[model samples]
Target chain A: MEGLQTVGSALLTLGLVAVAVVLSLYERLDLEREIGVAVVRSFVQLAAIGYVINFIFGLENLGAVALLLGGMVLFAAWTSARRAGDVPRAFAVAAVAVGVAAVATLGLLLALRVVPATARYLIPLGGMVIGNSMNAASLTLTRIRDDLAEQRPKVEAALALGATSRQAVAPILRVSLQSALIPLIDATKTTGIIFLPGAMVGMIIAGADPLEAVRLQIVVLYMLLGSVSIAAILVGTLSYRSFFTPRHQLRKGVSG
Target chain B: MASLKIEVRGLGYGVCGTEILNGVDARVPDGEITAVVGPSGAGKSTLLRAINRLIEPSSGEVYLEGVPTGSLDPLELRRRVGMVFQIPALFGTSVEEAVLYGARLSGGDADPGRLLEVVGLDPSLAGRDPQTLSVGQQQRVSIARALALEPEALLLDEPTSALDEAARRKIEELVRDLNDRLGLTMVFVSHDLSQVERVADRLVLLADGKSVGEWERGDFFSEAGERARRFIAGRL
Candidate 1:
């Protein structure tokens, strides 16, 4: 295939975005402005990331890679925290969840020798893991908060019966974590059957060996499951504490 | 006379700079049903919750059988002083499971059938889902669940407020039976003065977040203050 120039590539993507904008406008969806903003923001953000990744990938030091990865997790946490709404210190919870999940998953992979501990291997993989984990944290926290609020009487009844906060919120936590994992589980179950995943397809388009791409994609999928589950669990456990007082009283008005 | 089962001294709860309960003091004697009654927003429920530390008092303390509520582990305190809400909120999938929930959490044993029977429920209802039961039946299941904890006291928050006349009578009879037979210390929040008249041995009158007066049933009906009289007259 002939290589397209940067301007040509940009215009091609812009053309696709224009199609979406036109459809939204014709449908009176009121999403045309949001689509335009998202397109612009994504373009700028991806361009900045491209430059940053280029700089980091050139460096051999682990410290630079860690710093960049930490920044990504922090940014992802802040975004997720917005969805967390009324939970006190929601941003801290998100940050801790994302940080813990990413570190634990990456550490396991390194210990298993599934992936080498190098910036080349760590940055992209860590970014994907952290991004999904952030989503899992936010979804679990928000859902748990909503569930707790909705089931306040049930929880209070449990607490009144001598159940601890953990005991009282167990059902709510279970449902929240399961819900948070559904998207990732669905994607994993359907991978390569309904649609080719982006990572594998990207590798294939870039001329990598198809078998190697599939193997890498499998590893990525498994890693995502682990990271998301851990993130959900941590977020659910920590965020629930904020919903009740030390005296086991359910604090009202915690809903977003 | 019964000893003081729970003491609330200067008990106050403030939320968002507004006081819900302020410096309210009262005594709930053992082996009797004491009803906290007043006009709406009188903090009757708040007082009940504070007894078990479910709503931590902003100032002052609750003494449950001599131990300050603040000094006890909340779970332990709650186990010792269980509560039943106006609307029964049962946990677990089935009535049996709901009854067992407290026992399981507390690492104790309770026979669901026996507990249900004690609360005037059919043992056959044990396997049924609590949601499938009538509101009154569910309330009985709620009482059975609390009883499984073997609490020294049971706080009832408008326990019969949602029931029909028949169910209300059933609950009132049950409360009286439990108090008379088991010598249970019961503190209930009630808006229905007639229901209060039927069951309460002593009454605590609250208005504007303070304890306006405390009286025995006969005294309250015949010798109440102007504020208390207005409450009784449904004018407050």
Candidate 2:
């Protein structure tokens, strides 16, 4: 009966998804198949990850934990790299930016003993940091490419008048960094008032103390803010070079 | 004999198997206005860019005053050879800021008021906002901005094409005056042959991405210059 309660509740959430599918059908949205597929995929993926995470939790080895964290970073980088179309060495750039950002934030967290050195705490927090930073790095790379291409004439005018590549692109870099960080900035600003964040909601559902859940959610939000900014700044600094020649000429057709 | 200030020797550029400038050659005389006249896709702008190392030529070298441009730092070369585009791409907000941009970048200094006067704009125009000015006025501002760098040569890429007839004539007069009074070496790209005759000391014809013929202004449209005649008639 105890285990059945947990299983029963999980199965009940399917009813919420069923309602969404029903609404899609009523509206003639033609999205019922997509909704069903997405729900099934999410269920299978989460179930697989749940089993894998539980097994790692039992082992309690740091190496296994580190390996899982590395895999998560690689997957996050790959996912973000897709958005960085036509950025030279985009995968490498995204990986380095996301990897460094994740490590820096996660290392500081562990060193400070903010989160316990267990799979339960580390995996979720690390995932949050990596996921947020991936979005940022991806945005920065895309903006840099698009803006540079769009502003080629102004850039070349500056270059033609003895301006360095750095001087010419400083404006674009500023805008890209601002764009990459704004989403996270807004999320941070509206955290508690606008919406209760997912981490805290998950903790509450798992029956953790409400106050404990709030405290953990605050730490998660702070980590995202820090790591996302780091990744964005890093991507901007690294990717601007790809748009110019060594002689400071704006490369031909840099935008995707 | 007039010395050649800018020399394009077999200049070529191609990308992804399409040739833009195919071993083009031209010689721009010092302290004179050399007008490059051609139809669309003639590579006139590309050749002008190569002279200042703005666009590196793939197959040949460009020399400025007999010094191989490849030997100079690109920034120094660009400073010595100013460029004004077809559109008046004025950055920042006001006219004065646009005028001083090159000077600021190169650590040189020029009075905005005087540069405006040099470009035939009123001194007070410097204080006005760039958006408030006409397209012709904006082009003058961009030209003045280039002049602030004290460049040895100026590349004008169809500078008057966007202007009305009155403004076009004014800019044409300005180009002629600049060469006559200041001895400024200018390579101007133009579509109108009459404008070329009004301002140019020499005419360089470009077609099929190469220089097909060249002549002094008097002979360009003269009866003896059959090649030039055929070119004007769209036969060459």
Candidate 3:
């Protein structure tokens, strides 16, 4: 009963504070509609997620867990592809690739008992890694596509001058991959000094020791760096080929 | 003996089963500039691209220097035959890097100073970002980059259509200079008849994806085909 009351009180306080922050930001930054939509969607989505997670946790079946994870991946992929307007199919492939690679690598760490495979630990950690990788892949794919479109004439000129499609598109590929990796590098550089990331703070709030929380955060950070790096590289390389035909000419339909 | 540099026979392309270039047949000569002039949507660009296999021909073959383009590795073929575009398409942040892109692709070293000089650009402009340069400067950089491969043939698609008058003159002058000095075999597509007259050694007039007539530079303006006359009169 007390636990329910505490959760209810905390929820109300959080809701009020969130509303205040959104209102203030909207007023100051002129992002009113965006803030409104984001807040409303976040509230509804979080509520729905809370119920679904409660149901999943109650079941505690490994198959159910796997199914939920798959659904999460698909959802992440779909969202990323939609956000990346042109090359939706390629973006979808990139998202799936990143999600699978990141989740599998992180899952192995947990499966190998490198990290405990508790639902509380695994689900959120996997979600964070997948989410970050999805963002990186989306950015990388979009940037590469845009770069290719913008520099198409130059690419053609290169092809005319004996450069393969890979050689022709190399400049854009290198730039996009580097740009996609920037956030991961920045976060890694600034970790613990500039910010205490959510996972570590959340763990501490959940009654974990500070030292343990920090240690787990470090693992999460490293996992994210690895996953995103792999995602960016794979997405950039594969997407370069996606824009070209088998004959190594830029495909017309692939244009943005 | 005059030898053909590029031969396109019965080339066609389409999307979702609609033909874009239909039965395009033409031969680009080894040491001359051939201007493909047509109204918009007449497959002028497609025809130029077809030579380098930039656009896959749905039902035809392109022979580059007596070797079928289809049989030859596209990378090797493209390396020997370079293309320029309507817009200045520089990829890198700086002008020098954009010029170096082709050289890098071909695994050749770029002499930036010489390339800039050939294109009539100031050497100081190399360090500036390509986006900061005028359209004319960017186009010149693109030309220089294409030349870096020391290609036997050069394909251009409406290369001067995007520039202002001064920029257009610069490109026209550069095209003439390159042709005369380097003996670069050039194939350029354009809708502007005057520009074609100024740059082309020969003109291949296309209408509705078919070649309607061919004329040498001296006789192109006096050609008698109705479509050619209409094109010259800007009735196209």
Candidate 4:
């Protein structure tokens, strides 16, 4: 009877929190209609995630875990490419690159005992790294595309003057990739001094020692930095060819 | 005949079966300012684009100095033939950067001061952002950029169409001066007949994707075909 009461109380509390979130979003974005849609989507997604995570924890199979991680990477890549706009097969490429890079880096850290190999440690940490890298890749690709469109005349003139496609877009490509890495660099530089990052705070709430939490957070930070940098550079370089042809002319209908 | 700088023979371009330039045949003489004049949708710009392979020719061939342009590498072809657009298109944070972009890409060294001077711009404008310049000034900076490669032929598509009369005269004078000083082969495209007369040594009049008439600049005004005359009078 007491356990049932405790569960009932927890349900009430969760319902209230959901209401509060909806009300807050409504107030902040002036989006009354969006609140209901957002709440429903969040509920469905979170519930689905709960089931999947529970299954993974129960099975604890390496292949299953790898498949789940791969799916996340593919989704991240698809979302990033969608955001970047009109890249020919770029989303698939970005997905494979970000997924492989993020998962491999985080997996190595786990194997090296830098972070715990438990599902709790591995899943969230891998997700965070992959998510951040996806953002970096998306931003880099978008900026490069926009810069190429805006600076087309200069690019054409360059081509006319004996420049290959890579040479033609070198200036904008350099600037775009550098700008994409700035946020990750800044976050790393200011990690502890500026704020207590989510991982450290979460660890503390879960009753870990403060020093231990801080050490793990540092590892996560460095891992993210490495993963995102590599993803941004690779995605930027590979995606550039999609914008032009083998003959170095801008591919018609590719530009948004 | 003196070597033709550019020869477009029966060129046509289409996208998804929609033709843009149809059967365009024209010869641009060496060291002559040949103006391609036509109204909107007459394929004036498309003709210029075909010459440098900016727009692929679906049916015909373009020869640059007797070598087929389609045979040469596009980058190498572009290096010898340069294009300046209708609107002054400048990129980068500063004028010098935008102008030098072409030279840097081509692996050539161009004196920014000399290039700016040739375009009738003050050397001090070099350090300033091109976005801050007026329309005419930006166009001059674009001219400087195109000239950076010392291209054998320059293609201008309504280069002064976006400027005021005062700016127009300045650009016109600059074009004339560039032609005389450098003996550059120029293919100038314009909708304005008077501007064509002022600049062109020879004229190729286009209408509905076809070359309607060809004549020397003076003769084009006097002995032009009825369709060409009507086009000039804005009657059709």
Which candidate leads in TM-score?
A: 1
Q: Per-residue lDDT tens digits of candidate 3, residues A70-132?
A: 777777777777777777366567665777666677777877787876566667777887788
True interface contacts reproduced, per candidate: 0.88, 0.71, 0.88, 0.57
What fraction of the native interface does candidate 3 get right in terms of contacts?
Answer: 0.88
Clashing pairs in 2: none
Lowest lDDT sum, 10 consecutive residues, model 3 chain A, at A1-10
Candidate 2 per-residue lDDT, tens place, B1-236, comes to 38999988888887667788998889899998998888888888878878788776789889888888988999999999999998887877888999999899877789999999998999987778898999999998999999998889999999998999999999899888888888999999988887887889988888878888778887876767776766655831
- By summed lDDT, the worst window of 10 consecutive residues in model 2 chain B runs over B227-236
Q: Sort candidate 3 into its docking category.
A: medium
**lDDT digits (tens) for residues B51-96 of candidate 4:** 8877677898999988999999887777789888877767679999
- Listed per prediction, chain B TM-scores read 0.95, 0.96, 0.94, 0.95
- What's the TM for chain B in candidate 4? 0.95
Cα distance off (Å), candidate 4, residue B101: 2.8
Using Cα atoms with residue i matched to residue i, what is each candidate's TM-score against the true structure? 0.95, 0.93, 0.81, 0.87
Q: Model 2 segments beyond 4 Å from truth?
A: A1-37, B233-236
Candidate 4, A74-184: lDDT as tens digits: 889889989987778778768866976776797689778886666766677778888898998888888888888888776766665567888878888889889889988
The better-scoring model by TM-score among 3 and 4 is 4
**Per-candidate DockQ versus the true complex?**
0.77, 0.77, 0.59, 0.53
lDDT of 2 by residue, A1-256 (tens): 2333675688888999889989998999999999989988988988887887998999998788789889988887787778887778788888889989988998999999998888888888888888889999888998888888888778889999999999999999999999999988998899889999999987888788999999998899888988998999888888888878888887766632
Off by over 4 Å in 1: A252-256, B223-227
Scored on chain A only, each candidate's TM-score is 0.95, 0.90, 0.87, 0.85
DockQ of 4: 0.53
